[model samples]
Target: MTDLRQLRHFVAVAEHGHFARAAAAINLSQPALSRSIQALEANLGCNLFDRGARNITLTAHGQLVLEHARRLLAGSRALHNAVSQLGNLQAGELRLGAGPYPAARLIPIALGELARRYPKVRVQLLIEDWASLRRRLLNENIELFVADCRELRDDPLLSVEPLRVRPMLFFCRPGHPLLALAEPSAADIAAYSLAATQLPEDGARRLQETLGREPLPDIQCDNFMVLKELVRQSDVISFAPEDVLTSALVGGELATLPPREVLPRKGSAYGLVSRAGHSLSPAAQALRALIFAGDVVAQ
Candidate 1:
């Protein structure tokens, strides 16, 4: 049997591509870390690392083992979280991941609802890109994620339920030059710099496809708040889901460009994505339900 500690060490080394750095990261002495890897490789009857001239690399066998190790580790974490929350949702932490847009709208509502229903449950939100969120979900870094379903739809290891299908809208600060025209052409919109928040490649690609040409983004940010502030203060235009702009629009700080027909009607659908075959904690379940309910009301 492989030791979880050794597997963790291996993952750290592989991630950093250097043993000394990995040792420092995991707070283990370099020699001790080396011995642990040696022990792991000996037990498995194969070398896990290729100690080459320039950079440390995973052997072919190490690559295969790394995948299995990650799955096993993730399963162990899920089991632990499930067991910890077996009782009433009185006290257990729920780690969640979400994209910038959904995080802005959904999390606060769900957190409030969850607090009302389960006051003792603690929650931590990890706002990240779709790729990082998926990786975290698989590795058990997050209990669940709410994000666009473009890539999650086909992933065999994960399960997703639709939350909302929202249309993309262009936004600019009130009295923006672009809004001066009744209808701005693609060229007209492209003339000014555009800003966007944390868009996945597929989402960006789809937007480009809709425009029939690539328009360079002058500013790309990971947080919707930052992007909103940039758009709110500057003449920069932004493209995002309607729900994401609700507060700003309602507050009269931002205005949508006219002629919605010019843009693509179909946009991304976001949802709850969790690892398949894993049991979610009671706290996670409650939060998921709240999210689903809130999404329905929003729709």
Candidate 2:
């Protein structure tokens, strides 16, 4: 029976400690504000205020009601704000995940655009391998993720939307021995240490077949930056999406190995992944649009 209006009146009176001043602050006449508070107290069967000769104070019951009223009002305001944000994309959060390659190559550009367009929308990005990202998405830790989705394409629990495919390339430091060979064989390249992030299942199988050995990087790292530095300083060869190697290649810090018959020139099958049948929030939708747009432009 008690309503928000009555609670507001009660809070105003409690905060001001004077009926006249509280009524003036709320643009209500003193008698009307008093009646509202009286009705609230009557509905709850308690005296919220103790009226004295010169000052008014909250009784024990009044203090308890004030705490509950503040919390309720705060929750109500948050609900209204969330509703408004859903319509306008003016404020909200986007929880996103990305595989190492997409995190390093694709996400930054899209996130930059998202930041410029919706400054109030908060973003939380988790960079991991595709399998880890899949777990996070299924657990509802992230609303969506961008990653190599070849393995997830047939997953009933996921919805995958393909992005522009990017060619993968192997690179080594400029003066590496592999670069000296006019045409390096898979065995020639594999003679030295290999470095990379976690490979997808198919990629691992192909590498194992090509090298005729175990498909494991001698120097495994999740971060490309670290892998790049390692390759630049050592005889380690590494592979990554072409875009991720652009800077190093352009600067001549690294050079790609000549395409070998044994090694396939496979491109990444990256996509946007989300839980099946789950709707994205407005902020997530906005970022998703930016990501798709950026992917098109990158092509």
Candidate 3:
């Protein structure tokens, strides 16, 4: 049976490229560390290293074993973390991913509630586009994410639960020319350059249907902050979920165009998405529950 300790020793040696340094790192005598590596190679019936007088390098077989060894060690660590956090949400870490819009609007409230409840629990959030968040979740870089449920539906590896429905609204800085119009046609809105957040395909379809045509935004950004800034400075019309501009709206920096009645409330839904079959840590689950409870599914 291969010992995990021996694998650790091998990894340390491979990383350091010197037995003395590796032994120091692992707090073992050089001879003991060397013996451990020898035992590992002997058990596998192969020379795991091309040991030279100056430095050592992994042999072809060593490289193969190193990859698997690293994976095994990583899995072991994950298992240990899961076990440690099984029932203890007070001290463990919670890692979450979200797109810019959700990160800006919904996450702050849920996170605030989480912090109020479990002050010791550490929370890490990654904000990016859906594609980036999806990749991070698939890689286990994050425990879960809040994003477009539509994107999560296409991937078989992810489990999704709908959290909130946010309607799309055309907005602009206060006193923009569009606000003067009682009911602006699609062409009227299209006449001015617009900036908007990147929408999923379904969201794009909905927007097109609402506009009665496919109106291409002059600036398409995944980050809502960028669109908000563009709308604030330039005459560019901003189009995105109402939540994305909640702060700006509250601060009186931005306002919906063509009146609230003209805006389409049939917008996108965001959800809690995690890798299928992967267990979340206790802190993560706690945060998820908090967010779900607070989400409230807008009418």
Best by TM-score: 1
Q: What TM-score would each prediction reach against the true structure?
A: 0.82, 0.71, 0.72
For candidate 3, the lDDT comes to: 0.78
- Winner on TM-score between 1 and 2 is 1
Residue 270, model 3: Cα distance from true site in angstroms: 0.5
lDDT tens digits, residue span 205-266, model 1: 75676566674455777688888888889999887889878888999999999767556537
The alpha-carbon lDDT assigned to residue 209 of candidate 2 equals 79
Q: Please list the residue runs of candidate 2 whose C-alpha ends up more than 4 Å from where it truly belongs after superposition.
A: 1-84, 260-262
How much is 175 displaced in model 3, in angstroms?
1.8
lDDT of 2: 0.84
Ranking by TM-score: 1, 3, 2
User: What is the Cα-based TM-score of model 2?
Assistant: 0.71
Which tens-of-lDDT digit does each residue in 163-213 have in candidate 2? 987878888898998878889988787788888888778877778778877
| Residue range 1-299, candidate 3, lDDT tens digits | 79899999999999999999999999999999989998999999999999899899999999999887876775675566567666655466677888777887788888998899888777789987787888777656678888777766867898888876777788888988877888877767767886766667766676567566666545788777777888888789866777767778899998887654444446657888988888777778887887787777433
Candidate with more favorable, higher lDDT: 1 or 3:
1
The better-scoring model by TM-score among 2 and 3 is 3
